[model samples]
Target: MSIQILNLNPCYDHWVIISKPPKTPNVLRGDYVVKLVDGKGLNIARVFNTLGFKDYICINILGGDVGKIIHAKCKEDGINTLEFWIEDESRINTAVVYEYEKRMLMVNEPGPVMQRKEVENFLEFFSSVLKENGTLVVSGSAPRGFGIKDMARIARFAKEKSCRLMIDISGEWLKELLNFEPEMVKVNADELRIALDLQQMNLGELLHIKDSYNIKVLCVTYGKDGSVTLLDNRAIRVKPRVIQSDYSVGSGDSFFAGYLYYEALNKSIQERLIFATACGTANTLKYGAAIFDLQDLESQLSNVDIMEEEL
Candidate 1:
């Protein structure tokens, strides 16, 4: 199956592993650390690779020295990447994790602005690559100077191309996409709350949105409580077999990627959702984001409980 991924806002994710905290306020060196090209797009790509799916094509906007590193890393991973170069330096996002302390602190940078020519270039490339029966995943946040109209245009183009679209974004970026009715939407509870302007994720409202927009599937994730996937007439909940996690990042992306894997196989909704939950739980067992071996995932497959939830 062909899946095209767009990471409009990419970043060099610098991870600082906290080993020993200083007794007093003083400088303490990290035990071990690493940097990875991240943001939802890249994370999904990583999971896809872990699962041995190599057909995904990623289109990302990169710039500056960090962008160079991102490109080199993607190449090293053997992923098919198309880089759109910009003038501004790409952003650096840091994640400090104190696993023993069960504490994690993340500092994120706003991404660079995309020029008019850059937007046109991306559109041209996207149009050239999109084909019938393919999946287009527009993920991550819009960069600085990116407007809602630009996002709407991309969704419209995907719709016109007759490619199935999956949305994993929030707020105004998502508000604009709703007009075009993507085939599937993956939003966490917080994202759903913000996108729908509600204090809670009301299942009825989610169903209404699906019916009103002609969306086929809407998935909302709740951190430890599992997730609910809503269809036109029914809703299903997929619960993880194991809840313990060390790495705090990439579970959502792993779930989405896993779901995409099953979707590509034309699996039933229940199998897709169950396998997605299994992937997320297996990912948590690994230290890094979206990192899981087949052994870990296969072991967890028996634990995921899929049940029908009343909408």
Candidate 2:
């Protein structure tokens, strides 16, 4: 079976912006440009497609005009989407800003609530797809009424089927699921602080979680400070590659995608982390959640510095 990504929650969007920061009233004197597309899972699927990986996106689709637009966009990207349609319209998230300020203010809609049937259907679909040993990535936030335990449930199912699960999430949701012991957990610095309840813990204390869980890999992304990966009884730190920032959105997802791609090939954890960071840096060179080009990724990989630190 091909690697399957079960994106339990996803979105559609219309992005509008100004090239420079607005001085007063935070209003730009230009046309409100609108671009519509699938959100998180779609972005990850697109990157996987660009990297020539076998993948599928499982999402819940609500029926409406916006849903039609989302479906159309997913088709354009060649993403094989298995959607569970419902009564409500899909949500629309917006990001508004001036490019020069290097800051974006976003307006997000609380997604539609899933009925019991919707959730059950998604679980059935996800389980059927994982009959064989393969990689399963469950990322992003759950909708209303769904808690971190939901993620743990999926992880549990994957575990029962002998599928490797990689999770990218934060807060209590992540904390609860850690008990399930995913194969890999990716957490950014801010999330790490909350997960370990370490407002004052040093790097050593922060790195100790690896010993406490059945997790094979623990990745802590430090934004511009680079990223640290703990694996095979060692912590490997890689400096972030410098690049002009077009937009930081989706960089983490891209990094995870890149990491998992090379990982599927059985590369060393150090090599995987380097490629992952390189992919994230490459993502900043483009606007929106654009796919990272392979050549650019390869070039950035050369500049990535990886060092093993004593725990």
Candidate 3:
């Protein structure tokens, strides 16, 4: 079975590095500038392409001229894309990288609000292209018109087709998707706590709820501290080699892509978790989102340590 990515909410992302904005009417000079598609699934797909993994397809919602730009970029990367057109233009998200502050300021727009017809059209398109027994990746925030219940419907549809559903989302939508029992879930520590409505908890506490749903794996990323994964009733903590990085916007996507890569190769579970963490750590060294240098990844991979933990 092939790999398929469903990222309904996509945006044209623009990144710029500058000192500061001028108060007077003057042109602000940027040290560097980049414009590209921004969506978690697309980020993961880029890693797939980088690793020369073919037979993968990405589907996203698009509209207006911005949509065309995303499509063109995907084509340039040699990624097969399925675009669903809507009436409203897709949103533009901008990130200003402050050289001195060493942090990025993000300004995001609410994506296109789907009409009833557009939603129906998307469902039709998803059903027509979805592959059976394939890996179904659903990621990113939703568009303005989509809600948790609507997302739950998609999860149910994937389950009906016997697809391995993997979701990387947050908030109430994450709560709703949990009901369908996805095969895999990757969330940040904050997102995991928020989803389970806990002040402080461990894998055991979360597993109390997930056990009933039969989720195969639950991964929680704790940024620099590393990540923990629960699988086969074993919880393991993965530590990565720390490296100086320009930005961390796409680390999670790279991690997920690495997990999928090893999964397709039928590697041991321990190898998958460690490789995923290394990919995430390697992504921080670059400016472009989801970009990973194989040399860096391989170097980091050797340092990735997996420690079995008491759950």
RMSD, each candidate, Å? Answer: 1.7, 2.6, 2.0
TM-score, cand. 3 vs. native: 0.94
lDDT of 2 by residue, 199-285 (tens): 664566656676677788888887777888777567888887576675777888888888888887788788888888888888877
lDDT on C-alpha atoms for all candidate structures: 0.83, 0.73, 0.83
Query: Which RMSD does model 3 reach against the true structure?
Result: 2.0
Using all chains and alpha carbons, the TM-scores for the candidates as numbered come to: 0.94, 0.89, 0.94
The count of backbone overlaps in candidate 3 is: 0
Q: C-alpha displacement of 273 in model 3, angstroms?
A: 1.2
| Candidate 1: pairs in clash | none
* Residue 52 of model 2, lDDT score: 84
Q: Considering summed lDDT, which 10 consecutive residues are worst modelled in model 3?
A: 19-28
* Candidate 3 lDDT over residue span 1-311, tens digit each: 59899888888788888866645565656778877787888898888887888878889999888888888888887877888899888888898887667788788888788988788778877888888888899988878887677788788779888999998988898888888888899888888788778865667676775687678898888888788888776788898766576488889999999999999999988999998988898888766678878887887888787899655
Candidate 1 lDDT over 185-256, as tens digits, reads 998888878777875457877787788888889998987678999986689988875677756478888899
